[model samples]
Target: MPFESIQGRGATRNAVPARFNLPERLVEGDWLDEVEALDGVSQRRTTITVERPKSILTRNSSPDIGFDRSINPYRGCEHGCIYCFARPTHAYHDLSPGVDFESRLFVKPDAAKLLHAALSRPGYDVAPIALGTNTDPYQPIEGRFRITRSVIELLTETGHPFTITTKSNRVLRDLDLIAPAAHRGLAAVAVSVTSLDPAISRTLEPRAPAGLKRIEAIRRLNDAGVPTLLAVAPIIPQITDHELERIVAAGAEAGARVAFYLPVRLPHEVAPLFRAWLDDHYPDRAAKVMATIQSMRGGKDNDPNFFTRMQGHGPWADLLRTRFAAATRKADLGTGRLKLRRDLFRAPEGRQMRLL
Candidate 1:
């Protein structure tokens, strides 16, 4: 059966992995087809589930990425980016890594409390807590739940340093909190812009803010004295690769101090989902895109090694790096890293500490 692209959703199918032994879902009878024929495909409304986890801070020892500790106020992003590497995480809950990973969302309402508890520990180490590492902290639900705002408030009060990476302009809504933190050298923001063309962006990131809005957000954040990094992440081969230089120049025009790019990574479930997406939307060039990606990835769908994973291997990868460096230089956007200050961190006064 051919996978049909869902309107306003990224994944072409909602498929559960075989490792979980979950039964495959199929519409039971012809009645569904009759209803669809009459009324067209029904829209998939997003469902939010509140999760109260014991810990809010996730610590990682991976040497590939910069930060060691991070916080994700939500799981399963609704932005519906088909290339999201985090999609496979949905499998742990016996859920499909495809559409279910985007529609069946989870928010941590108690994230602030958990963060407070973690920070108040006697021997808590102070390091930058990365937000939006696994799932975007500023996803649409944050506007309703305010869980991410609460976490940021707690961090701000304690003078702890953190970084935010998001594709939404909604981060501007919390500028009151973030501006002060940036002044204290305790915060920075990275805005990810996948494509400048609205049409390409619509299908590539169905629910994310348009590229122009995100670019404007970079300008606003910079005007507020917040150091902004423009991230042109997951630069898909034969898809949005042509816009690399234009994106960098736009970021520079918007006052982003630094810029970076990553090649599209198709690890685990993301591979199949992205392939399906290409088949549906770009059938004419899907094979070419995948072949170019494989050539860059050393003839594999993805490279799992630490260093090579971030920087793809082979000729195409080298060319991408060269182009990125040249583009950044041309745009006057520094390739230097943004360092968030951790010296100003103050542990929240715990109950036992109050007695002292």
Candidate 2:
């Protein structure tokens, strides 16, 4: 059967239902048509659709995470990191967490406006707002949409404190605004650098900026007096894990004040996609790599228990933590901790306005 689009009168929080159970392949119908039948079919270009969320600040009570609120200006990141945990979120929009997650995207045109409204409420609490937590705020689409920049502008104007995490150097474009905010302890940034090997980074995070460029971004941000941190995230075991020390050292040399690392996490659809990527790229060592991952993930493809999920469990996980701690000390990075100034936050006046 041919695929069809389903439309609803109004968007709902759970509006888009996923069709994950559909057959993986389809065959052409036997209609007795000639070769010319396919000759005139022109593919339609997919268009971007904007979805205005009623509210933007996603609140979390999970003790394992540091931030209580975050703002993602866009959905379905274009960065196309195969192992991205946020990919499965697209399923809620009736979109595939694979290709559609990257190609078919949703932009929140009213993010800044919604944020202002929320913050203006009498009971609104001012805490460091996290950006780029779910999907990258500075992904390639940001260049055109400019939603992330708009949010930053609002935060700067309101004298609100915020933290950003990104894998792109494109963030530098807004340094003019970020630098001043940093001067007031209202802004800080973390750059995610998965691997120093350009080739590995190319395949692992196909659309993200190169590893060196990210490091350079850290150097430049630090030079501008921003509290920069190097996030050696998702340090895949037996793969990029070997480069942990090298990454920390490089970030230290780049003037990063702090360094953090997260062991690879494979949740929901991300598990299968990551496995496929592993099979395609490192067929020879796929088994060994997965074995190492399982060792860290409590002998399973994933470990979902609170704190354990972020740090992992078992001997292998312990070893990773020990190694990371040692590397950070050797590199003269943070003595295992870097703190952001929370006392500097001030509530911005006025209701949040929407960005058209």
Candidate 3:
């Protein structure tokens, strides 16, 4: 298969990862051959697989990240972001991390029920549960599944503090539930805006909402008393680096109280997928971009060190930090933490409690 940009998808090719030792899927002549003759090439459609897990809470002890536990309502985001670090997880299902990670999705319909069980457990501890930690909770399928909404309703009923991170404006649909929780300081939101340029955004994250719409979402979320932050994540060097100050300024103007950024990190399978994306979109400067990224990563594709992983090293990394700091100051957006209150948590009612 040749490398060509799909109409609405991000990955150029569905290369099977070598680490998994999975055999590549080949096209054999059959009924599909007749269909291909009628219609040149087949278009891949989104497929959803239902998953029912016994537990919903994911606990992580990474020293670099802020939260200790989180919830993901869905797997394999349809937003199709070329640089998504979560793509490698699809390999666990014997699926290609490239296109399969985008088109083949999984939804946990039992998320709310599992969450209720966990919260109702004896001696259950309470901490802020982050949403959209691994994959987006508000991807397009969310409109129909409404699993995220169900989880939020349960969290709100129990007064559990939580935070949401997403690139979609669909979150506003749940303003009725989130606004009240935010008023009690139990909820916060961070909207990730990759770039303000429509063309750049379209090619980079083909299915995510436009950047301007996300900025508007921040404005509305803040207007509803929700502590919304601007997340300029995976700031691509040379490509989106120039928009650092501008993006910060835009976020501040939209009433975001604080803003944060992470330099592009390509770990595991993301590196090659990203390379393919660069070849398709930014061929002119792909080499220059990779060179600068390597310099920040100690002349490698990625740096996995704790502190340095989130914040890169070298002069190029230093320049980004300096530029980000100045831009935040100029835009009056704080780089400080937006904490959510955990004291308001109350365990969900168990069978005995409900009977009582």
Candidate 4:
């Protein structure tokens, strides 16, 4: 009945109170009036488990998305960004999108093997496979698992092209692999810097790398020849939207080659979670913010329309777009999309040490 809350976490409340396929409304709240909270309420600890999926690449047909194939080495994210569009996804596992989404992670340690097999398949098309599309591949768990690194190694060995999106400075750890790949026209990186303000960023995305750190990450990536791009995502209408020009200029100063922004998307369980967050952090502007979001979403919390979903269609959306365009223009930040080479792809051959 109340917001999903786990004291030290970013999400103020558990948006998905009940597990998927098991609605809480099915049972009366009075029946379980004595139900108490689970453990780790104040301080959540990370739990990593392995998942060996049958396939590694997930293909999508979304018109707004540039890439079709994506690789998610993990099922849940640890960054704990309250407004993460991927939060609702944790519900499929019958888990809370709030605390569980960040603390309980599902890793794919065998991702590299599966990817190698899939790539070796006959007639398999070669394209730039995106990583961290669903959940970040370089979350803190990565330090122990290194699955993302394995994926990169495999792609590099096979001469396949790929791109990665992350908010962590951890990408610098793999500069060795990424730089050479970039030189070979096989890799690019997108660094997500949500807000420049540390205080806002702390509440907006508690576990993600800070805005200045991420800007430095962009700098290091570009300096290492990785062709870094800045992603100022989920431009919350009244909250972080005002920082559009400042963010763009900051990215350009860090040597980012291109920059982009996306208006906040509240889909499925994310709406309630974000609403709870707004109430907790920006109580005064919560109603006004939601009002603007609804206006942009056609009087709803979300709009799943094809083109409208990416950038809503309305006066507010138009103004946001115009602002983004102006900011990018002023910063000289638009260089078009950097296309990775498909021609360089090479599948392994047998007897070449059995392609080992």
Candidate 5:
């Protein structure tokens, strides 16, 4: 693990993905706070770079994913969730999935323009375009850039249906617009509440909203007439899995219409990073936790097959699914997939020209 010792960030260690054929480096001691006192570790500050991509809509026909298209307003999330599957994407740019992924971020300022152009293209078809499917769209930089707001505004104006997933209450800032769109069957939201335990949340997802805050956000969204769901995502097997039922119960009590859960997944660089995190935070149970994860993932760190990837396999996976089902039923929260209307989608009219 070159550049592997940088500690105290979301990832305990990291290196450039081997696929790039780049040589990696190692630190003897305290390179950017590696192998130093916990308090001495440098704070990882976030830097957002603006990008003007040619397109904003990403299309995929994967059978496992509900939506056909999605828009990631940013690349490299600052939320710093250790288990994030999207972390490997940063490796494509010669960046470490460790500190770089959390400290360095990229945002699309012209996302609205590209989205409008794509929607207006000839032969464009309508489907609910998903947000926050990769990097969280509501990550803290959003407060300054407001890129997500522009996206929602464009969608609202065109009557296009969309689904947003987030762990931030920042989405509440757009409640006035979201409530209207949701009323017209054009918008929905899912708030990911990974753990109700403040300690676990602080370590696992340092920058995401606290669990109760997310639940409160769901309740508020529902009260405002937005269809809200609870996402108990990336459930750690030996760690947070036991909280599945409680998570569902809490969210349902808070007015979430439905609940969804996915067992922890360790894809590519995420596996090693996660193992290091386990060793750092839970040294005693690290081996057992990895063993249990491999068991659920069919003797591998992860199962990449489309159908099996989300829920996983084997006894642990089955038990989790059963527990989730039982909890959702007991709490009377719908487990059914949310289906947003695509018929309401229409291209926005051309931007009005300003007099010179």
Candidate 6:
């Protein structure tokens, strides 16, 4: 059977002459047949593209999130974590939130420029700006683009306070800037460590730095006198949940001053991608994992309710929370109250002119 290609956005036709008509949304996974029949398909290398958003900071009103304004220098994280909650955001650009979300990415080349402009606005209130909120600002592409670094430099120059959340140790590269900012009460960082198991880290967050390296990053940041927090996010029930205590213990050992965790969220396309990942990696335990998730999600794949979304409700969720609390206490993480200094915020010079 000769392969037939389908055209733009319509019902999928038979790619293999007459194998059988599958749904337009589904395509057969026969690489040999595809290579033999299509020259163009075989010649493409997945390349990264730059997207110039007119603005950099995104405003949000969700009660669950702490920040009102956040900046993401890149879209479609290269870390390729199958459980990424930000994956569905790609669909808004008419791109698939699956493979395309991990491969075909968009970097905001003008991110630093736009951020300077936004921050310089006369009415721009100086609160702690959040970075790596939607997509990781320090993801792999950052090594080349260096947009995240530029933004950090700009923030530091203006004496602005900011917060960062990232899973990659690549953030350490900007320590020269971050350390000084921390000295001035202008910065805080949260390093997200999902699991201590290297193998699980590999499959769960395929392209992110190894867990050990992230621990090292935590150590390095804290050693430099930077305020560091350990984020044990997306505690997948029955799967990675068992490692929560170990992860928290390790973070405390590495000198993390604070710790936090959130339940796994599956919004839109992410649900199917995560399910597929489970089927591929942990087929035997997939059903139990999802059942546990459902128990927390009010008997569904997810619960989008604001506060409920971050921390699910149920026995499993409750137990996970209790365990995390106990482990952090045992490890002496966050021994006493610590808070980011908002008093250090000062409007960057020339904000009014820049906004104009």
Top-lDDT structure, candidate number: 3
Q: Which candidate is the best by TM-score?
A: 3
Task: List candidate 4 segments past 4 Å from native.
Answer: 1-5, 15-19, 23-42, 349-356
Q: Write the per-residue lDDT of candidate 6 for residues 42-119, one digit (tens) a residue.
A: 321235778878898889999878788888898888787878888777666555666657655888889888887887
Instruction: Show how many residue pairs clash in every candidate, following the order shown.
Output: 0, 4, 0, 3, 0, 1
lDDT of 5 by residue, 1-356 (tens): 22333344587665777877755533223354442454454444466677778999999988988888999999998778999999999877777887678877899999999998998888888888899999999998888899999999999988899999998988999898899999998899999988999999877988788899888999899999999989999899778987888889999998999888988989998999999889988998999999999998889999999989988889988999899989999999998777777787766776764353
Model 6 has an lDDT value of 0.79
RMSD of 3: 2.4
Candidate 2 deviant stretches above 4 angstroms: 1-47, 335-347, 351-356
List the lowest-lDDT window of 10 residues for candidate 5: 26-35
lDDT of 3 by residue, 1-356 (tens): 32222578887767778898977653222325334444366666677899988899999998989899999999899999998999999988888788889888999999999999999888888889999988999899999999999999999999999999999999999999999999999999999999999999888898999999999999999999999999999799988988888889999999999999999999888999899889988999999999999999999988888989998999999999999999999998898778888788888886667553
Instruction: RMSD for all candidates, in order, please.
Output: 3.1, 6.7, 2.4, 4.2, 3.9, 6.2
As for lDDT, the candidate ahead, 1 or 6, is 1
Model with the higher lDDT, candidate 3 or 5: 3
lDDT for 165 (candidate 2): 96
Tell how far residue 100 is off in model 4, in angstroms: 1.0
Model 6 RMSD, rounded to 1 decimal: 6.2
Q: Which parts of model 1 are misplaced by more than 4 Å? A: 1-5, 26-41, 352-356
List where candidate 6 sits over 4 angstroms from the true fold: 1-45, 335-338, 342-356
Q: List lDDT for all candidates, in order.
A: 0.88, 0.80, 0.89, 0.85, 0.85, 0.79
lDDT of 1 by residue, 249-285 (tens): 9999999999989999999889988999999999999
**Which pairs clash in the backbone of model 2?**
113-353, 113-354, 116-352, 117-352
Off by over 4 Å in 3: 1-5, 26-39, 353-356
Measured with C-alpha atoms, the lDDT of residue 254 in candidate 1 is 96
**Residue pairs that clash (backbone atoms under 3 angstroms), model 6:** 120-351
